[model samples]
Target: MMSALVLYVTDDCSLCDQALELMAAAGAPDFQSVFIDDVPALQTTYGWRVPVVHDGHRGRELDWPFDVAALRAFLQPG
Candidate 1:
């Protein structure tokens, strides 16, 4: 099975919503949304940076305010 990207986000976060839209616009690879609120570790790690995209396979993370070019690069293999 292919490893899916993980998107960390919190409820009612406008930036998170923008990130989702950007991902769709960038034709992002398969990904799963994880609410940081539900996971303590995640909440602690990404509480301040809610709209984060974790590339588990590459062990990299893309923070918010990224453009399509950056998104494509983040999706690329290392």
Candidate 2:
């Protein structure tokens, strides 16, 4: 299975929660969801860009709102 990382960058963002839920439903066994508000550097870099999903292994990122297919592709190995 491929490893995936998701950065849900948002402070009190509903969209971020939605993204997490989506990932859970998509068979993402293990994924990291980092909130932008929690990290200073992430806040500075992606202040308003919430619900961003990052594939650490692949070094790829996908910002929401993303469809199921797009998300699956991002999570999978190329």
Candidate 3:
């Protein structure tokens, strides 16, 4: 089964765009995207770290600068 994952992102973010590309290359499972632009708390937490992959099932977060392999590992179920 696929794990629950959330991709925290923002508008006009190049890195976030790259993250989507990497996820596709890594064959990522179904996930939800949450924009941080309008949420103050989200902005505070992920302002500098857009394109973050949050593993809701494991309560883990994978920050940017991750490659396809890393994304694959993050998408793996426990």
Candidate 4:
């Protein structure tokens, strides 16, 4: 099994919903959704950039506005 990707998101964020949809469409690997609103550090780091997809092991990130193709590329091993 592939490692789980971390999806940083906030409540009431339409973009986050869209990002989830895109990830599903792209057949992305397992992932965990992290709500950043409660964590000060996470809020500061990803407040303006919600819907961020991160590969923990690889330390890579894919921000919003990504399509299926870009998502596929981002999920690739470095």
Best by lDDT: 4
lDDT of each: 0.88, 0.74, 0.89, 0.90
Q: Write the per-residue lDDT of candidate 1 for residues 1-78, one digit (tens) a residue.
A: 645698889999999998999999889978998898888888889999879999887788998879788998888776
lDDT for each residue of candidate 3 in 36-65, tens digit (9 for 90 to 100): 999999999999988899988889999998
- Write down the TM-score of every candidate: 0.90, 0.80, 0.91, 0.91
lDDT of 1: 0.88
Clashing pairs in 2: none
How many clashing pairs per prediction, in order?
0, 0, 0, 0
lDDT digits (tens) for residues 1-78 of candidate 2: 444576666767888878777887777657766767778888776777778887777777788788667777777777
Between prediction 2 and prediction 3, the one with superior TM-score is 3
Position 10, candidate 4: lDDT: 97
